[model samples]
Target: MTNLSAFLAQNAIKPDSQERVVSKRFVDPETKEPMKWQIVAVDSDRDEALRKQNTKRLPVPGKKNVFQPTTDYDAYLATLAVECTVFPNLHDVDLQNSYKVMGAEALLKKMLLPGEYAEYLKVVQNANGFDVGMDEAVEEAKN
Candidate 1:
């Protein structure tokens, strides 16, 4: 987590940017090794372009709206929680709960295994804030 903050700072990720989302740790299944988590913002333009390219289908309609990349913090966190693969009981519980709360918003997608997601959650829980990078973004935005 601390390392992730540093990496983000080194990369100049802006705190105020709507694209900013907290990254979580994930574990690789093949080797059972832990890996850094990543936060991803929704790429609406790219998605739209994809949809246009594949107009044969309507993109399951409203699915994108249910989980827009930036604002879906809970969904995003939930996504990570399901990816760590370290915890199964917790993952299943969270998935079931999220399914109910989201009313299929999260159900439509597959979640990471419990064991994998658990390990990842451990890394995320210790996640750090990117103070230096955030400061730079603030200054840059002001300029």
Candidate 2:
């Protein structure tokens, strides 16, 4: 996994364009809720504008902040790429490799298992090509 991690780590794109916009988000741990933060900077100076943009964009909702109990995370900020609105964070190859190694199906199952739909496990089993009577399990759950 070290190679995979290294590949991911290196593939991280460094921000290039100067003009950036930033927004803040604060999370409520008890409910895992997020509040959109106010936008901070728009300066005439390129350096100042870039600094503000970097500061504004970094924090992502589920990926970065997990809400630790000991300290106040209000100071913590993340600046995400504005282009991500149009595209995904990682390239196709990286995403595919990540899925292969991380087993995104299992992650989805773990997240969805608590809901009223108990077919998460069945779906995951089927996706993984397990012959564990998944069709019957899914059909039964649907009923």
Q: Listing every candidate in turn, what is its Cα RMSD in Å to the true structure after a full C-alpha superposition?
A: 14.5, 22.5
Off by over 4 Å in 2: 1-117, 134-143
**Residue 72 of model 1: what lDDT?**
33
Write model 1 residue lDDT over 30-130, tens digit each, in one string: 76666433432324464344334333322435577343222233344444333322333333556668556443224323344566544333444333232
* C-alpha lDDT of residue 139 in model 1: 53
Per-residue C-alpha lDDT of model 2 across residues 1-143, encoded as one tens digit per residue:
25565458568654332211111233456766553212222223642343344333335468766432221111111111111212222234465475553433332222222442243233323322345573563443333
Record all residue pairs in model 2 with backbone atoms less than 3 Å apart, i.e. clashing: 57-78, 57-79, 57-80, 58-78, 58-79, 58-80, 59-78, 59-79
Q: How far is candidate 2 from the true structure (C-alpha RMSD, Å)?
A: 22.5
lDDT of 1: 0.39
- For candidate 1, what is the total of clashing residue pairs? 15
Model 2 alpha-carbon miss at residue 25, Å: 22
Summed backbone clashes in each candidate are 15, 8
